[model samples]
Target: MGTYLITGIGRGIGQELTRILLSRGDRVIGTVRDPGQVPAEWEAFVKNGRLELLKLDVRDEASIADAASRVNEPVDVLINNAGIIGPDRQSTLNMDFEGFLDTLRVNTLGPLRVVQAFLPQLRRSPQAKIVTISSRMGSLSYAKSDRIAYRASKAAVNKVMQGLATDLAVDGIAAIAVHPGWVQTDMGGSGADISVQQSAAGLVKLVDRLTLKETGGFFDWQGDAIPF
Candidate 1:
């Protein structure tokens, strides 16, 4: 079984992804902003030694470095799943400048920080893969101005991961972005298109098939390629 390191596993898709990985007998190192607030179900996995929960705030570099130092094994897959939706005020007409900047910091720079901090562990793996959770709303090919802050952040991260894929090519590491479809989560809301289970399962399958040829590509949870 491979070792997977996933960020923001306190709830939503992150939590469900962690559950699926553990159920399949893979070791998972999941991050949460606050370990005390994690769901009770996660505790059983921790007790059984299948999961290791670490406290991390994706926007904080020190936290990322500290968490990376704690990992003893090579990481086969690194999922940059932690992200935030900008405030309701972030619109084209009346944008919240501070909130937009914060959104970029978390959604864009956060994943880069985590990947750099864990590069050593990832490089040690025989088949390393880096997956960043992006959004279809970020696609410039089909642009919409509703949530401009979030859209801009995801778009920027897609480019960042593409650059990472190129820079790490010599090391044989696959890096790509994935759009998790609108799942029913705190951010996706109650009327979202798909359930968390569907998205998580699809994402797992996509990650499983990732290869060097597919690096730098943006894809949906179902493994379909998405235009940048």
Candidate 2:
């Protein structure tokens, strides 16, 4: 089975992703802002050896480096799932610039830093992939309204994934952006249409089916490509 690293594994989509990966017999190294933050279920996963929890905060470079060093095996996949929504959704004219910056720091730059820090280990893997947990809100072509911060950061990440795909191709590593859909998570809210289980299952299927040819494209949970 493959070895994977996932950020923001304490709760919500990240936690669900970890559970699915472990159930599939893949080894997962999951990151949390604090180890104490992991729920009882996650702690069980950690104790069982299917999952390893590293204390990490995507906003902190040192934490990212420390977490990367904990993995002794080469990572087959890296999931940049850690992200945040700003204060509240609003029109561009009413959005706060500082909130937007915070969103970019976690959702955009955090993934970039993780890739940079873990490139060596990823290169050691025969078939490595980088999956950024982006959003449909990121698609400029499809975005008819404004989320301001969330949309901007995700869009930036989509572009960043493309650039990484180009540079990592020579080493046989693929990078792609994925939209997990609006699931019932803290970020997604209770009114969201999809459940976390369904979203995670679809995402895992997409991940297992990813090919080098698909790198740099934005995809949905159903494995269809989304235009930039």
Candidate 3:
């Protein structure tokens, strides 16, 4: 089984993805801002060395680098799943500028930081892939104006991932952005269309099918192509 590195495994899609991968015999290296936040049920995996948790805050480059340094083994896949919904007062006309900047810091720049710090381990693998969990709201085709900060951050990250796909092609690494669907999580709320289980499962299947040909593309949780 492949070694999968995932960010923000404290809950939601990240946690589910870790669980699925571990159950299938793949080793999981998960990152969390607080180690205490991890579920106790994963103790078995942790004890068996199938799951390893790293302390990292994506917004902090030093922390990301430290975390990356701890993993010497090749990482076959890296999933950038940590993100924020942004501030409550986000809008085009009225915005929380500080919050908007922070949103961009975490959502847009965070993935790049993690990827750069972990490039060595990724390069060690014969086939390496990077998947960023972006949102459909980031799609330029959609003109919705709500939550502008969050939307802008996702859009920016998508562009960054596309560029990464291009630059890393010579290294034989594939990178792409994916919309995990409106999952029913703390962030997506109860009224969301899909459950975290469904979204995580679909995402794993999609990742399994990914190849160099699909690099730099945007796709949904259901594996459908999406306009960026």
In model 1, residue pairs whose N, Cα or C atoms come closer than 3 Å (at least 3 residues apart or on different chains), thus clashing, are: none
Candidate 3 per-residue lDDT over residues 15-54, each given as its tens digit: 9999899989999999999999998999999999999999
Per-candidate TM-score against the hidden true structure: 0.98, 0.95, 0.99
True-vs-predicted CA distance for residue 48, candidate 3, Å: 1.0
Q: Give the number of the best model, judged by lDDT.
A: 3
Q: Residue 216 error for model 1, in Å?
A: 0.3
Report residue 212 deviation for candidate 1 (angstroms).
0.8
Question: How many clashes in each structure?
Answer: 0, 0, 0
lDDT of 2 by residue, 1-228 (tens): 889899998889888888888887988988888788777766566777878888888889998898888777798999999999875745677877778888899999999999999998899899999999999998988756567788888899999999999998999999999999999999889999899999999999999989899988999988999877
Q: Give the TM-score of candidate 2.
A: 0.95
Best by TM-score: 3
Writing each residue's lDDT as its tens digit, candidate 1 over 78-118 gives 99999999978988999999999999999999999999999
* Candidate 2 clash figure, as a count: 0
> Where in model 2 is the C-alpha error above 4 Å?
none
